[model samples]
Target: MAQAAAHTDTQQHPIRLYLVVWGWLFILSACSYLVDYFGLAGYPRWSLILLFMMLKAGLIVAVFMHMAWERLALTYAILVPPLVLMVFVGIMVLEANYTLFSRLAFFVAGS
Candidate 1:
């Protein structure tokens, strides 16, 4: 098990780093709460919320999950499917908008 021992040593699990990351995560969580308390309106609010969410998720994945030191292939395997799904979700949103507009137009014309 010397190989296993050597492999474990390569990953530096410093308490300080964890503390710092935890502090940042806590701050980000507080900021998200502040945004809701302030009643931010419209796209700007959503943009900020999504940005903060992604940042928090990224930090969790990178640090807590230890994906940062992983191989490129493994990293892409874990990340790419969600990215492709997001692309399809965006496309579906556009199609939904078009369908909604058409239905509203047809009903308006009939009335």
Candidate 2:
């Protein structure tokens, strides 16, 4: 009696929500495939791929993982660290490119 009532009090999402998410996931996947099938090259190709990947990942995390129902602080805790790490990685890549270019320039000039 009490247990049944308590269980019913828990958050319950409709099946339609999951179905819609699944459909979106399928569509996003097809778009991702099309990016490669069309033979897009350079920044545009990689940009589309990454954008689709992030959108799919975001959808999975928010809906499938039940993060959408979680508190804001919890969502931030789970999401922020990875975003910060990605920023740091981008910085490192820029630094590495600059160092490589500088070294090449010095070598060529010296010779």
Which candidate wins on lDDT?
2
- Judging by TM-score against the true structure, name the best candidate: 2
lDDT value, candidate 2, whole model: 0.97
Residue 66 displacement in candidate 1 (angstroms): 0.3
All candidates' lDDT scores?
0.93, 0.97
Weakest ten-residue segment in model 1 by summed lDDT: 5-14
Candidate 2 accuracy as TM-score: 0.89
lDDT of 1 by residue, 34-108 (tens): 888999989988988899999999999999998897899999999999999999999999999999999999998
- Listed in order, each prediction's TM-score against the native is 0.82, 0.89
Q: What is candidate 2's lDDT per residue for 1-111, written digit by digit as tens?
A: 999999899777999999999999999999999999999999999999999999999999999999998999999999999999999999999999999999999998899
Give the distance in Å from residue 31's predicted Cα in candidate 2 to where it truly belongs.
Answer: 0.6
Residue pairs in collision within model 2? none
- The worst-scoring run of ten residues by lDDT in candidate 2 lies at 4-13
Angstrom error at residue 38, model 1: 2.1
